[model samples]
Target: MDTQSAKDTVDIDLGGVSPCGEVIGDLGDDDMVTVLTGMKLNLAFFSEKVANLRNFVMHLETLGVELEGFVLDREDNDVDVGCVGKFLEFDLLCGVLGSEVVELDRFLDTLYAEIADAGERVTSCKPWQDNLLDPEQCLKQSEEQFSEIKKLSASFERTLSSYKRGGIGM
Candidate 1:
């Protein structure tokens, strides 16, 4: 919660001992690699979400559907169109997106909370600054990206939820 403290930063310390046996630096390559891989996964996952959002938007336009409208069978995966990502609990968010979704109105608020939680956890990312690969810098950037994704995801979720809850399509 305290994002400003040093302890809250990305913990990518790859420290090693000097001739005097003092820990002089960090071994941060692992952290850098992990951050990079995580970003790629985030990108792909968000892409699916954006796609699904777009499809649902199109469906709304085509049917003049509004939120609170009668929804067809959510059991039909084909109706659950748009960007999909797994929602990780201090974990991963992509696989969760694949689950069958029902009740978009109630679900959007939950999705927003999930993204916000990711933003908080990533804010605590801590990688040492001196590494040649600069995992700390990578963590900073990744956190920013996660924050952005959270905002966008929350927006789409709400907009789609509103459309679903409206009775236009009914």
Candidate 2:
């Protein structure tokens, strides 16, 4: 899909505005810890997000397993080529999906650990395993995660720009 069309699917507009400028401008030298804590908390969401995706992929694998077993259990040696091909294709897709989920989970785990360690220096910004029972809570959590991600991106962009401008003092 083209860029505009792809964006239209979600339908969120930036209007060329970025939070980095506002966030960076609002930060004082003393608020570095706060900023770092916020970033760590925001980044920790990766673990939660990856875990959710892992669950979904594993659920897909379950369906694939059930369907494959059903087809194989039929003692008929003359299965249609199309049906066999579909099962094989589904299995292949499941394998790829499963492997990707594992890799992402591992990556998220490592990053989460690092962020947790860093967060200890400021405050514990660990992401919680949200067991939201109510729909309202779920919606609230989603909005909060989205805000954190946006803030994290803004802070990261600001930091990168600062380093590029020779302000990092390498």
TM-scores of the candidates in the order shown: 0.30, 0.39
Superposed model 2: Cα runs more than 4 Å off: 1-73, 123-170
Model 2 per-residue lDDT at 82: 50
The sequence of per-residue lDDT tens digits that candidate 1 reaches over residues 30-119 is 434454455445444544555564454454333323222324333323333221211111012211222312233234444445444434
C-alpha positional error of residue 85 in candidate 2 after TM-score superposition, expressed in Å:
2.3
Per-residue alpha-carbon lDDT of model 2 for 10-103, expressed as tens digits? 7654443222222233333235445444545554465466445546545655655554564555554545555455455554554555465456
Q: Which ten residues in a row have the lowest lDDT in candidate 2?
A: 124-133
> What is the overall TM-score of model 2 with all chains considered together?
0.39
**lDDT agreement of model 2 with the native:** 0.45
The CA-based lDDT of model 1 is what? 0.38
Query: Which prediction has the highest lDDT against the true structure?
Result: 2
